[model samples]
Target: MVTILNEQAEVDVTPLPRGGDGLWLSHADMTRATGFELKSEGLCRGEICVPVPKGRHDFARDDAIDIAGFWRYLGHPVAHDASRSVWALGTGAGTRRQALASLEAPDFTLPDLDGRPHALSDYRGRKVFLVSWASW
Candidate 1:
């Protein structure tokens, strides 16, 4: 059993594909993590249904549905651990598409060299060039 958490909730479930993050998740796990179910129409939560793309509705060797693949097909972001047990799926394609359409960076506060915080919104109309390099 693996525990997956999002911003608001967490659920324990068996992740498919043994050890690899193969885009698949057990139906129960997927439904609990996301409020949607893998329905005939698509991933549906309540009255709304986001149709899964044809051929992309592939399955894992164990026959679990590929929830991650569905999200990727819709252009949503997702992340999981090396164990393929935990996951953090981000906002769906609709939300991201709207953000992309607006072309606005979400407001963020970052710390400068002096430990002072700078908010992107503070320079609303001005252009800022950020050149960052790190020696890891």
Candidate 2:
């Protein structure tokens, strides 16, 4: 999800419904929903085209995008009031963020190659190291 810090608090965003004529989404939702696509390619869901920076599609793990700038470019608004000190993300039509369908982590219990039940959280307080190699 998109994370932003303002004078008052932090804001988290989630995805919105389809068929709505606006651009409103969380960072995670935007990444997944938009298939990790950025603006320059102009290929987006719902047949929408936005003009993004030339190399935005090549974003790396450490890269950051200005959410407010992106929103404004996509016809959305990053709204804020001096009194509230809160920033409200708005779609073109004044739509607010959507309710998250589920926030629970995915079930990851599974058996390893040796048929042993492996629970990720089992090592919560311990240090674990994973190593992998390819013979290619």
The lDDT of each candidate is: 0.69, 0.47
Query: Highest TM-score among the candidates is held by which one?
Result: 1
- Name the 10 consecutive residues with the lowest summed lDDT in model 2: 95-104
lDDT value, residue 73 of candidate 2: 60
In candidate 1, which residue ranges exceed 4 Å CA deviation? 18-20, 53-56, 59-63, 92-136
Looking at candidate 1, what is the lDDT of residue 17?
A: 58
Steric clashes per prediction: 0, 1
Task: Report the lDDT tens digits of candidate 2 across residue range 26-135.
Answer: 44545543333454554354566554555763321223334445556656556655532334555564322222235333224667789888775776676656455788
lDDT of 1 by residue, 1-136 (tens): 7666765468776766544445557777778776778777867989979876665455422346666676665576778888656777677768767877898875667778998988879988889775668998
RMSD of each: 7.1, 16.6
